[model samples]
Target: MTGFHYKGGLRIATLLCFFFILDQPAYADGVRPGYQVVSRAEIIEAMRQCDDYDPTATTNGARFQGEMILYLAQKARARDPQGLPLFIGYENWFQAFMEVTARAEDAMPQYAQLSYQYKQNTEIDYRIDRVIREIVEAPTPELAVNVRIWWEYQPGKPDRYSYMDTLSTPNLKVTNQRVMTYRLLDFGNWVAYDEIKGLTGRPTSGILGFLFRIIGEGHILQTRMAISKDGLQFNRATAKKGFIKRIDTVTVYPDGKMEKDIPPDRPDLLEIAKRITQPLEIDYAELSGEK
Candidate 1:
């Protein structure tokens, strides 16, 4: 009843690991003479530009903003290897910029407005904006990233809910280590109430309903990543207490290919692994705002 769920779980774990890895700093020297060292003030300015991004501009202004935000993030990572302020800042800025780009590209003014309103009313913690505030008020030497997600379904009761938590510190050994853990609270239910709700539009009752929940509740999944001079290694596990109950490993090549055993049926996991491992490629002309 208690074990790792590899089918859909690996995909989620891999994605989270990939995001965390993107935040990690590369081993390199200080910033170049042309690029300025990232600062909280600079991040704020960049965010403001992203917030005011105009879809109607003659030029691809939104994309330019995104590129600038990414450039700043890279410089920040290079300048401050010990502190994650710049890295976190860049992540938040990039996310907001992407939202603007997507909305503008799709010509969805209504959705864009709604999205902006939602962000305005939401708490900083719920959004990446909180990271910006924390980095500005009090920067930490090390970053500790931990995320958790869950869902439950009980007939004749409220069926679905989810939450997330993030913390940064100076003591954690794995500065760049990223871990994503998912714990299902219901027993023997593969499909959470939310999933069933999406499909059937209502929670089903009785023995038939229980039969579909074969995934089980209280099942936990944890994925960890380690970066070395050679490449990256991702370790996945199902955990109970603080110890790993079961474990699996997947290695990613520099070319973004999987070097580990993966089931033939799960081509999705293989694709994700490749995407995460592939080296980053950016065009200088685009980033430089050149026509």
Candidate 2:
């Protein structure tokens, strides 16, 4: 399958779009208490300070935990008009990947053996760390990274993936294929994967083949994912870009019943939000001899 590559210009456009939408009242209200718009300078300073800041020096590390809570809240609030946060995209992507792979492994235990090989053999250009590190290291007017992923799965063979970055590739006679592309934005990454499906897999010699020749290939299921840079924290997933535009507290039942704008299942984020809104438990003024 073909790999996807986007130039640096898209990042600029994405950032403009991300911040422009923040002017809306809905976006303003999206930020809960204790969350502030953190600048790059502040992010850098916090990273530096917290790297060495000893939470153990204080009572039960409450102050350090408080600082982290504040940092997380600040990052979480850094969402686009679509409500995709900046700090947890990686986590989201990983979760989705694991879920799919888990099902595959459960059905075919043989898939588990090639898991490591797929990562090891994939093209270097689109490797997860390589893509993220390249973006983090040289973020500017001209970007050099081409973010994309390609994988082909055959029932008994090791998965084939990410050999080239192109629009389309030659189809295998019996392989199932997936093509994934990444739009690395200043705010976060937009990940879209298309699972090749439908009559496209039919032979091109008979009446079905003649119809296929006229209509080309089959339909693709495109799943759009938005994630933070490190791919470890925030995410908007499982649907097209515009479907879930905002995050609301709701629950869905197995029977298709829906609850709109209800309380969330977990209170961890709420507690963190409350903690970040308060003063640090430790007094920094009294500390001496450490920078």
lDDT of 1 by residue, 1-291 (tens): 101111211111111000122223553332322233343445444434432224223121212222233334334445553333222222333345445455442453322232222221100011123122233221121222112211122245333312110110100011111112221111111111101101111112344225324422222333333222232223232222233143334443333333334345655456444432333221111111110
- Which candidate tops TM-score? 1
Give lDDT for model 1. Answer: 0.26
Candidate 1 is scored at a TM of 0.25
The lDDT for every candidate, in the order shown, is 0.26, 0.25
Error of 2 at 246 (Å): 12
What is candidate 2's local distance difference test score? 0.25
lDDT of 2 by residue, 178-206 (tens): 33332322222222222212101222454
Best-fitting candidate, measured by lDDT?
A: 1
Deviating ranges (above 4 Å) for candidate 1: 1-213, 239-245, 254-291
Q: Give the CA lDDT, 0 to 100, for residue 262 in model 2.
A: 23
